[model samples]
Target: MSEIKKSVFDAMPQDLSDEFFELIAGNDEVKIERIISRGHTSPETGWYDQAQHEWVIVLQGEGEITFADGRIIKLGVGEHINIPAHCKHKVSWTKPDEETVWLAVFYS
Candidate 1:
């Protein structure tokens, strides 16, 4: 058997003026996505209320997340968290000098 080789750090756009998202895989019940951020944050007046549960990991660099109720979560490399469906959250900050890479799994 042959192994399929891929790299999570590949294809990063040189111009990181905005965050980048790549959909790696998806099925009826689950979706895998990769997000690259360099000093990115959610809109000032908005929060993400997702319909599906999301499990996210910081693969590189660091980031901070804020919940609607004022709770804050800090994540560095290899750190992860599970967000329940309909939980309101927003990304507060990401490392500015380097890319903060994240792997997010969404499931119903």
Candidate 2:
């Protein structure tokens, strides 16, 4: 079998939309993906309530996450967090000039 190899910080599409996500690998109950963000934030009126748990690490740039309970978490390169499923949270801000590369593993 062949293998796939790529850089998480590689250049993104020149005409990308709001943000970009790429599926790397996964199984029936778990998944791994890469999220690339630049000046992106969650919707002002909503928070993410996912069905799967997420463990994420930032590989580049910086970001902030706010929880429903008024908790704000800041992350820089090499920082990480584990978000439980169904937890209400939203991305508050992201660095605008550089790509914020994230490595995330999601599981039920």
Candidate 3:
């Protein structure tokens, strides 16, 4: 078997919006997705509910995320946090002048 495989973003569907998602890994235990989101402060940006447990880390740029409990976290490159499944959360804002890259790993 080949020891290396191309990452999902190595070749992704370009037709996606400024916010793009690519599944990078999945198995019986976990699923990993990479996200590229830009200009998150737009009126269109809002909250989300995850079906599975997730942990996300900022790979680039800066942003803020808020939880249903009204707690907010400001994240920048190299910072990471975990979100439990079904927890309501949202990306409040991201620098429009820069891209916000996130490495999100989800597990059941």
Best by lDDT: 1
Question: Looking at candidate 1, what is the lDDT of residue 106?
Answer: 99
Of 2 and 3, the candidate ranking higher by lDDT: 2
Residues 1-108 of candidate 2 have per-residue lDDT tens digits of 557676876756575457888898899899999998899888899999999999989999999999999999999999999999999999899999888888999999
Local lDDT at 77 for model 2: 98
lDDT of each: 0.95, 0.90, 0.79
Between prediction 1 and prediction 3, the one with superior lDDT is: 1
* Per-residue lDDT value at 98 in model 1: 95
lDDT per residue for candidate 1 within 66-86, as digits (tens), equals 999999999999999999999
Which one wins by TM-score: 1 or 3?
1
Each candidate structure's TM-score, on Cα atoms with residue i matched to residue i, is 0.95, 0.92, 0.79
Prediction-by-prediction clash tally: 0, 0, 0
Question: Between which residue pairs do clashes occur in model 1?
Answer: none
TM-score between candidate 2 and the true structure: 0.92
Candidate 1 structure, TM-score to reference? 0.95
Tell me how far the alpha carbon of residue 77 in candidate 3 is from the true structure, in angstroms, after superposition: 0.7
